[model samples]
Target: MIEVLVVVGPGLVADAGLLEEIAAREFAAAGVSGTLVRARDAAHVLSLLSPSSPEGVGCAVVLPGRSAEVRSLIGRDLGAVVWVDVERADGVTAAAGATHLHGRGIGGLAWGIRHAVHRVRHPSRRIAYGPLPEQWGELYLPGADELYLSDADGPPVVMLIHGGYWRSIWAADIMGPLCADLAGRGLAVWNLEYRRPDLHGWDATTADVAAGLAALATAHGSDALPSGADGAAAPDLTRVAVVGHSAGAQLALRAVADAVAGEAAAADGAQAAEEDARAAAGEAPAVDGVRVAVSLAGVLDLVEGDRRWVGTGAVGAALGGRAPEGQAAPPYGDASPLLRLPLRARQLVVQGAADDLDLVDFGRRYARAAERAGDEVTYLEMPGDHFDVINPATPIWQATAQAITQALAAGPTSRG
Candidate 1:
């Protein structure tokens, strides 16, 4: 029901024949039954992209030059703009300030087209958790009429945090398919988008995650979400789950630990210590309604990750500094989930058998450490690579989703 403009830049910048071929393949795979228009140049493309353009074109797949006019065409409301660069030119399209896929060569173009089609079919309501541009999340809910009229308290909410080693080039669009899949299964999904440490610093990234979680928990009764064809509703916080991938897994666990600590600090002195002790003994801590937390091919142990120089020292960059020489200190103590053991929520740690060996080690060791700290944990090690866990079509994700569904169905675990 959407029109896609595959703009082939004049010159050797793009392969016109390959562009058309990929577009055809992707459109067919997406089951869009939509129209694809090939434009010879940028001007030709722009003319066809108008609101009154023929056949109602709503999105573009562009292979562009480094010109200002080309970059300015990004981030428009015209569905989605996906910029393609086969030579892996770093961060160019991302710096254009748009929701796009770039730098993966031909694969990027194919995924971008699929992403564009997905957006048109499953529209999400954008809700801002803070005033900043990066402080927002896309909420996807079951759009059925019965869902709106049902008196029952809505579906369980799932908060998804994406990962690209905390870099700006990788945005929440990476989680698009997973979000749509979960929403289709009748779960309200909040796909969180936050400031990356590379551009906004580590503190900002962590703070944004915390604020986004808080906003998700409180959105139900407030005027924070706007209603329309998207039908954005406050998420069902009574049963909430946080699902984070890669570096985002660390963020998810850290947020839960922070929430547990805050709740303990606010209680009566002796009672708070008693509750903390109980929580550390595998009992549910007195915190908000977050029941389960899942980590997919996660970077769980910052201390070890830093020591091993994981992600080419991305751990240190995310924390804003390298780990101290002798004893791991400061940021690692506060930010690392391994250091903050016995999080109040039940934990689900999933890792690909063939992923970075370091991540497999992290997942295994962290699950054991969490168990020793009296936290309930379910660890699933499957056959696949790093990206397989995020791809909705993969068996790994199917198993992960099954685990999550079973956990949610079990309801809140009774305190031991």
Candidate 2:
């Protein structure tokens, strides 16, 4: 049977007969027999699913500002244009928001009217790296609030880690307009806000992102960065970079593989017998440095993203439950950042191509296992889904800010 589907937003187009009553109760609850049609957007539902338009038995397209043309027909359509954000939750979750299947499209509608017109035209600057309250984060840009905003110390430090699958029902202000479009490009945006793996599982969201990245590397080793409006010079945390999406790109690729396995355990001396028993049963803190990272359509193989329509299982609801059956070690080996491997850091792995079916082959299986354990992987492959690389009105957010300036001008090459 031929399949063609497209479902955009504004509450699925103010109700076009509830998209043929949800494709006739999903083919009568799978007894299998399809027929549902409606197209006034997504380019009139891709000229009726191309290959010479006229196929039947599988088409459900609802329209309405098709959120800036569903990323050029999501991965050449086989299915995966499910966006329905209508501005994030409140009262019926913002009138039914979070149907979330943007497979790679989570930002559009003029990137949410350019981050609510830059939060009422520039308003941010709360900083605290740690000392809890989710170890504080926000710093977004565009003259943060004016006092000498951008003459230097900005561009470099992306950080950002928003993806709801880890639940607490999604936060980090859904990457506040991609952190105000990377702090209006002078780039120095943190946007963290942790703790939601159901209160205290996965060690309270990996120790609040390792105490807000060890209070942002002890305030970038005491240069105390954080300023924008009128007087800049704040970001550039020694050239840091991390960008995450879906499940915060599996916690920024397992905290950049535990900070490149804690700098190979302090240059191969002691640590690592499971990091001295997860630091004598505590979990994540010394927050080492991350070279570069990004994951977007993430979920990098957490045992095939723990079931129930991906992210609905959200990797066993963020590793706090599922384990028993013949359990021969199923606890997501080091919490599945592609089973921890080759992490000198320099990964990209953007991915999209209509992102569901559990993150459309997770950036080609984590760039073929971080390029077979040598790590300096790139693997871009764009075209929207999984919230279109955090939707800055997609072009996959300028190909993910030019792959984070080519992972900050590439350094450590890997592929032993």
lDDT of each: 0.75, 0.60
- Residue ranges of candidate 2 with Cα displaced over 4 Å: 1-158, 166-173, 177-187, 190-231, 239-246, 260-262, 269-312, 316-331, 336-416
TM-score of 2: 0.31
Worst 10 residues of 2 by lDDT: 90-99
Worst 10 residues of 1 by lDDT: 89-98
Give residue 272's error in model 2 in angstroms.
19
* Tens-digit lDDT track of model 2 for 21-92: 555555454344444445556665666655466655143333333455643444343332232343342211
**How much is the lDDT of residue 218 in candidate 2?**
65
| TM-score, every prediction | 0.85, 0.31
Off by over 4 Å in 1: 10-12, 15-18, 33-42, 55-58, 75-98, 101-106, 144-151, 225-234, 269-287, 413-416
- Candidate 1 local lDDT, residue 305: 93
Query: 1-416 in candidate 1: lDDT tens per residue?
Result: 66776665545366667767888888788766455555556576677667687756676666655555655666445445666655444444343233555556666778777767677778887787777767789988775452422335666778899998887666788889998888776677889998888878887888788878878655667666433224544455777789999999998888878766666565546666765764564333333777788999999989889889999999998888988876668788888888888886699999999999999999999999989988989999999999999988899999998888677666784333
RMSD of every prediction: 5.5, 18.8
- Residue-pair clashes per candidate: 0, 28
